[model samples]
Target chain A: MLRYLVPLIVFLGVAGFLLKGLELNPREVPSPFIDKPAPSFSLPKLHEPEAQFASKDMLGQVWLLNVWASWCVACRSEHPLLVQLSRANIVPVYGLNYKDEPDDARNWLRELGDAYVSSLIDYEGKVGIDYGVYGVPETFVIDKQGIIRHKVIGPVTPSALDNCVLPLVRKLQQATAQTVVKRTEVEGCV
Target chain B: MRSLTVGIVLLCLLVFVPLAFAKEAEYMVADPEMEKTVNEISAELRCLVCQNQTIADSNAPLAVDLKNQVRDMVESGQSQSDIIDYMVERYGDFVRYRPPMNASTMLLWVGPFLLLLIGVVVLVVNLRKRTAVIKNDEDLSVEENERLQRLLAAESSPQVAKRGNSSSQKAGEEKS
Candidate 1:
């Protein structure tokens, strides 16, 4: 009985892992930047080329860094949702206009409605590379301390926003920058 | 005949034209040494857009960009591991064609040998059990041996004639 049972258990364990693997999306490579500080960059604003927008400006605020381009067809799908989210005033959505002509980007916003608090021009896609953005329409939920908490690889649909991003953002918003203090407190106790 | 000639010309153009263009686009770097370093690094890194391909083999825009990134890093005199680490820092270990042996991948590295070990154990146990069963069948106890000797003596006596007669009668009945 033990002999038969052991083989059956091992077979089931392998089968279980394979079944779980079948359900997983292999296309979504997990980002290394999660829980790490957001890569910092200052770039010219799409609307005003003379003016600059920096990532450090978003410190002390829970925000969304959306990597997008006019050329990206998927970005159009998530545009309305982003616009709505921006209007809702729940979280500020900033755009990193990845590898787009300034004119085309501005025109796209004019047609689709601007969803960003400020759209920074990543003309060479340097900032996008820094953010570890492979696919356009990637979204990152960043906390007040400028750490990237979560990343959405593809288009941000309504369900994803409601289920994952919004909840995390709300939680991050509620929490204070007490991590440093908490660490010291634990040290004191120890 | 003229149409056939045109068709042959078209085929030649289709095949050779791309070959010419491909030769031009094949080597992105001029320096052979720099190209070798870039190629080595690219071979280790995965193309994010085309998940199956290494950046060296992929033609996707992102793959090209990554190759150029590798080239730039090579030009700047960074070591191969340093460039790979930079990519890993951005893309995680998934960007690597060869996964590093860490706590997560320790099982992946050791799994085959572990399976072989289990198989050997099972085979040994099964062989031993079979040998034990055969030995038990071959070995007879003292009381059993005595009983066998008594049966042989009884068969050799006049009881054999009686048994033989009974079997012959049964055979005759079957024949009838």
Candidate 2:
């Protein structure tokens, strides 16, 4: 009887793992960049070609770095949500226009309504590669110290924005504000 | 005239086709040693977009980019292991076509062999049980053996013996 139960237990164990795996999105691979410093880049602004944008400029601010392309159909799906989030002014969203023509990216923003603080042009996609972008429409949440907090692969859904993105943004913002206050207090004492 | 024109167009295409292919071949390393290292490393790395294929074999855009990255790294004096380590560091062990043995991958490495061992044990146990049943059926007590022999002796009387001998003779004649 014990011997008979062994196979059933093994089968249930495998089934449990399979059920858990089924709930997981295979494309939602965990990024190694989390808790690590965000990869730095200096690329031209998409709207203003003569101007440039760099990751270092966004230091001491909790921000979203969204990697998008005009050619990516999935970006269209998430565009409206990003626009809504931008309108809320919860967090500053920066766009990395990945591997797209400058004119086409400008045209897309013109049609879709711009949601980013400043869209950076990664024309050669070298920045995207550094960010470990395997697919387009990936988003990263970076903290005040330039450390990456979270990475969301694929389109950002409404639920993801509320549950994952918004909550983390609020937490990081509070943490940074406290740190600023503490720093000022120490400086006054000095 | 139309057929001749078609033939000329086909001839032109044939002549230009090799040139297009030659241009694509330019991405390969100039040094044969470096090319071999790139090939080996590419074969080990999985194509993220085309999950089942190695980067070397996949034509997906991401795969092509990764191949180019590998080629560039190989050309820049990076060791073969360093390139693989960089990819694994970024993409995790999932990027490796052949995952290394570690705590996370222990089940993947051992699950099949464990299953085989269990199957062999079950087979041996089942065969032993079946043989024991057969042996039990064949086993006869001393009293049972004596009863069987007595019954046979009673059945073979003088008249039966005479008839049996005649039947045996007939069977012998048939065999001959």
Candidate 3:
């Protein structure tokens, strides 16, 4: 009886792991950048080619760094939601225009509507690699300290924005603000 | 002269045809030594976009870009482990074709041996139980021995004797 039961128990254990594996999305390679400082980059702005944008410039703000390409179909799906988020002024959304032609990227924004504080042109995708962007339409939520708090691979769906992105942004903003206030209080007491 | 011309054309074909067929490495850097290092590293790294293919084998844009990144790093004189560490740092351990042994992957590395040990134990236990059963079967009870003697004495033919022995064995199995 023990012998018969042991094999059955092992089969169930293997089956449970396989069932869990089936539910997991293979495309979502977990990013190592989470809780790490966001990889810094300085690239020309998409709208104003002469003007440059740097990652360090957004150091004191809770912002979204969205890696997008005009060629990416998934970016189109998330574009409207980003537009809505930008309009609501919840979090400043910055775009990393990855491996796209300047003209085509400009035209795409012109047609679809630009949803970025200022889009940075990463023509060679060097910056994309630095940020460990395996897929386009990946969104990164960075805290005021410039550390990446969360990453949404593929597209930023409405549910993801509501559940994960927004709440985290609000929390980080409040947390960072408290830190700043505490520093000032210490100085005042001194 | 015509034969000479044909020979010359054949010679040219022999030389140039192989050149035409020769495939240049798509992501080759200027340095051959560096390119070899780049390839070795690329083969070790997984292509994030196409999960099955290594960055070395894949022609996907990301793969090509990664290959280029490897080449650049190699050119910068960074050690192999350093480059691997850099990739693992950004992409996590998933980027490595050969997963490093870690707390999470300890089971992955050790699992096959563990399974094999379990299989050996189970086999040994089952075999021991079977041997124990056979040992128990060898000792016939007094009533069974009396019945066996009666059957053997009654059976005159060798075939009948064989059948009686088999039937007694079957009875023993049922008892077990």
Candidate 4:
């Protein structure tokens, strides 16, 4: 009986060990923001609540909304990449600090040379949750139609920005051009 | 009346109701090509902060940073394969959820079948040995029967001899 049980234990132990050692299968599912209106958020400015960033504020134009925080180590690692991305003027890059103090975020921005057009202080992270942020440093690519086009979940890299973002900008521009033509056609009909 | 005032407020609330307001717009996907690459890479990349979640799935800040790194790579005109290779080099294969199969992972592919084969062989050997012992018992019936008869004679010797006396007398008549 023990002989049989010994092999069974060995088999299970080995199988368990192998399973633990195996690579995990992680999926890249589409975020809820795709093809939907951006979630509205009213966050006070990092320094001044008088000039806040709201979801409705990004309508009628394209933009890149990045969620970040000083407490997030990856945000710091990706900071240099954001600096590089600022050079690309495809769309304005804005910051939404997820549950961070204004002073720390300001210091981080100051050190990093302020890549965002303006930073919104989401001290409570409620706004970040509404955006379906699983964590910090998520970036959404928004088109002029106020629809979310793509989401990047991690830090920015120079190559990633050029290869993934520029093409989308081009696509959005093409779409905008078609709309301009349709508008002219509608005028002619009138 | 208070009822009238409440009705007005209710009407106003009904007209401009606030339901579950989800801020879905926080995610702005890039162009199709770039978004595809970025999302793909994020799925493969590990979020160091939440070590378990991939950059594609985790809502953690680290996940976002890793995603931005992938985006940066895409924006810099690097190929998907190259970016992944670079990440692997920097962070080791642990960074990728589905790492490329190689010598290091051979046990993962081949271990289960080997274990099953060993288990089946052990079972077959045990069954064969048990059946062989049963067949050997069938060939020893005569010796076992004699031993059982001797044991009974020793226990009831006097009574059994009187019964055998009549048989002996019959044997003498047969001889004459």
What TM-score does prediction 2 earn? 0.79
What is every candidate's alpha-carbon RMSD to the true fold?
7.2, 8.7, 7.2, 20.1
| Per-model CA lDDT versus the true structure | 0.86, 0.84, 0.86, 0.72
A79-152 per-residue lDDT for model 3 (tens digits): 99999999999889999999999899999999988899999999999999998999998999888988887888
**Model 2 residue B145 lDDT?**
71
Docking class of predicted structure 4: incorrect
Task: Flag clash pairs in model 1.
Answer: none
- Residues A142-189, candidate 1, lDDT per residue (tens digit)? 889988888888999888888778777777888788852211122211
Give the range where candidate 3 chain A is weakest over 10 consecutive residues by summed lDDT: A181-190
Each model's TM-score for chain A is 0.86, 0.89, 0.90, 0.75
In model 2, what lDDT does residue A84 have?
Answer: 94
Spell out the clash pairs found in candidate 2.
Answer: none
Please write out the lDDT profile of model 4 over residues A116-186, one tens digit for every residue: 88889877665664566655678887777777777777776666566666566555656762352222122
Model 4 earns a TM-score of 0.44
- Which has the better lDDT: candidate 3, or candidate 4? 3
The residue-by-residue lDDT of candidate 3 on B1-176, one tens digit each, is 99999999999999999888676645434778777888899999999999999999998999999988988888889989999999999999999999999999999999999989988998999999999999998699999878767665646556677776777676578559
RMSD of 1: 7.2
Candidate 3: lDDT of B164?
Answer: 69
Error of 4 at B50 (Å): 6.7
Off by over 4 Å in 4: A1-30, A177-190, B1-176
